[model samples]
Target: MIDLESGYILRPVNPVFIYFSLFCALLLNLLPIGNYGWVPDWLIVCIIFWNIHQHRYIGVTWAFIFGLLMDVHNSDLLGLHAFSYALVAYIAIAWQKRIVALSVASQALHLLPIFLLVALFPLLMHWILSGEIIWWALTGAIQAFIEALLWPLATRILLAPQRRPIDVDHTRPL
Candidate 1:
């Protein structure tokens, strides 16, 4: 039970939570939701939250690794998602303090551009490789908006284990 007197979590954050969450996100993205104009980037949000709050455990490296995995899963060009994830991680790290200090709504506003760029990375790569513009680029804009809106919910759920209640000890039943 959490002690109200002193705020501390008895259990430390588990790597399993991180890994499992990331894996689950990958699975969710792979679900048959391709028809939706705006599927959220679940893994990216989790990665950024971890890097921002627990940089030592999760950082750009995790982003790159999982991103590559995502690319492979998506069956698109390899390293495309990896490179984009790494870029977003780098940007998130650089602005983490500022972003974290803001309210969730404000955070979305600040992060929208970053997410927009991430969502656009694939489209940009397509243009460079195929020399053809995709009308689907418009969908990326909607995706960015949805991603931003999800920031608060994702942050709360993913970071729950890390936010522990206070710890209190009593020698005799004070």
Candidate 2:
């Protein structure tokens, strides 16, 4: 029987690490990659990764705040990132258990659709709001693919510590 209850034991996580990582993601997103039109949404990637690992605790609020920051940094429409990240957060939170149950690669596969949806939401919203079909918006598909490709690598790097036994002093008996 698969022991689903045997989730990894973890040490108390410092919230600072999460915030610092988000800050790093913001910095990454600010890099000059606009010429490709498929710039990775670093903050969304981080938000979704954490939402999978931390579930509801890392949900809509973080998404909204970071999205707003991203919008300001990128000088896009004000709520573009906000709406996209919030929607993605809700999806991630809703599917957290099922996705987290899978191995990292499987999780990345499942996340592909979610990432694509997130990439397209803002474009769809802009089309509706501006009353014009944004042809260039289709580039979001490439952006989604890039983000999906990144999920497993980012998950492995960030969650590696969670998968390992917490370092303990051997002299102390449990």
Candidate 3:
């Protein structure tokens, strides 16, 4: 499909590539990097990328499953990450059309708020349950900015696989 707005012709995405990317993102998130508030959530970034570009294949259900896995890995309250992931997935889906139409740079601007909500959901939930706010968690907002900043680069990398060959041949007309 040729994106009329972006002028990029994209071939059908390989299911294998999608799964591999998601798995890699999950592994990255599961790495033993201490709970650093500024570290961007690689899994969610991957999820959002697919949500915007391949929503039919990657949706909220996938997000929930990845969230649950992270919850187990982190040994945190079960379903907390699941809920946050699903919430962000839903938001991304809701705005997928608009996000898809924008330039990659503009798309980052739209994602900033979605990232903010994802970053804050955990802290808000924790405060409500424990009645003690973890002020350090507030720094997680920085992760959102970092993710937004990297959006353009991420888009280029993720879309690279699907971009049609620039030199069209009669044998392959995408």
> Local distance difference test, per candidate?
0.80, 0.78, 0.89
The segments of candidate 3 whose C-alpha lies over 4 angstroms from its true place after superposition are 3-6, 166-174
Better of 1 and 3 by TM-score: 3
Write the residue-wise lDDT of candidate 2 on 44-142 in tens digits. 899998787675357798899888887887688998888889888998989987986787778888999998887888778888898888888888889
- Predicted candidate 3 versus true structure: per-residue lDDT over 1-174, tens digit per residue: 566546867878998999999999999998898888778899999999998888899999999999999899989899999999999999999998888888888999999998998888889999999999999999989999999998998888888888857576898634
- Pitting candidate 1 against candidate 2, the one with the higher lDDT is 1
**Residue range with the least summed lDDT across 10 consecutive positions in model 2:** 1-10
Candidate 2 lands at a TM-score of: 0.84
Model 1 lDDT, residue 61, Cα = 90
What TM-score does candidate 1 get on C-alpha atoms? Answer: 0.83
What local lDDT score does residue 45 receive in model 2, on the 0 to 100 scale? 91
At residue 112, candidate 1 shows an lDDT of: 94
- Clash count, one per candidate: 2, 0, 0
